[model samples]
Target: MDKKLLEVLACPVSHGQLFFHSQTNELFCPASGLAYPIDAGIPVLLEAQARPLTEEEKQA
Candidate 1:
């Protein structure tokens, strides 16, 4: 993910910062407990497209 783009993007739910997890190829929002997916090198920031973070994922 582009660091510059990540810096500018915010979670649709919380409007909080998003941290990109390379392993999952997804952007995680700690505040909103949502994981936004990246499709074809593009971020799917839509709330409907986001998945809830697992409990284990929250800790790590």
Candidate 2:
């Protein structure tokens, strides 16, 4: 993912900062407890597309 693009990208629902998870290819919003998927290098920032984070993932 491009650093510049990532810097400007925020959670669509909460408008919070996102942390990229390389292993899962997802962008996580700690504040929202959501993980937005990245497919083909494109971030699917839609709230409907986001999945709730597991408790373990939250601690990580």
Candidate 3:
């Protein structure tokens, strides 16, 4: 993922900062407890497309 692009990207629902999770290849918003998938290098920032963070994921 491009650093510049990631810097500008925000969670669609919470409008919070998103951290890149290389292990899962997704952008996770700590504030919102949501994870947005990156498909073909494009982030799917839609709230509808986001998945709720797991209990373990939140503790991480």
Candidate 4:
């Protein structure tokens, strides 16, 4: 993810900062407990597209 783009991107739900998970190619929103997927280098920010984090994922 580009630093500039990451800096400006926020969770669609909580509007909080997102943490990038490179392994999963997703943007995680700690506040909303959601992981928004990144496809083809673009973030899919739709609520329906987000996956809820598992407990293990939350701890990571």
Candidate 5:
């Protein structure tokens, strides 16, 4: 992912900072406990498309 793009991207729900998870190719919002999927290198930032993070994921 492009650093510039990532810098400008925020969680749709909380409008908070997001961390990129390379293993799952997802963008995670710590504040919201949601993970937005990155499909074909494009982030699916829609709230409807986001998935709640598991307990393990939140810990990670």
Candidate 6:
């Protein structure tokens, strides 16, 4: 993932900053409790495409 891109990426729904999760290959929005998946280097930012964060994931 590109550091510059990650720096500017925001959650589509909450408009909050997104943190890159390299191990999961996803972008997490703590405010929204959503995880946007990255597919082949492209981010899937759609709301429908995002998955809800598990309790453990959110706490982490």
Q: Quantify all predictions' global Cα lDDT against the true fold.
A: 0.96, 0.93, 0.93, 0.94, 0.93, 0.95
Candidate 1 on 3-23: residue-level lDDT in tens? Answer: 999999999889999999999
TM-score of 1: 0.95
Candidates in order, TM-scores: namely 0.95, 0.93, 0.92, 0.94, 0.92, 0.94
Model 5 error, position 7 (Å): 0.6
Estimate the Cα RMSD of every predicted model relative to the unseen true structure: 0.6, 0.7, 0.8, 0.7, 0.8, 0.7
- Candidate 6 — what's its lDDT? 0.95
Error of 5 at 5 (Å): 0.7
Model 3 pairs in collision: none
Error of 4 at 24 (Å): 0.3
Which parts of model 2 have CA positions greater than 4 angstroms off? Answer: none
Candidate 6 lDDT tens digits, 1-60: 899999998999999999999999999999999999999999999999999999999999
lDDT of model 5, residue 9: 90
Higher-lDDT candidate of 3 and 4? 4
| Order of the predicted models by TM-score, top scorer first | 1, 4, 6, 2, 5, 3
Model 2 clashing residue pairs (backbone): none
lDDT of 1 at 23: 96
Question: lDDT tens digits, residues 1-60, model 4?
Answer: 988999999998999999999999999998999999999999999999999999999887
Off by over 4 Å in 6: none
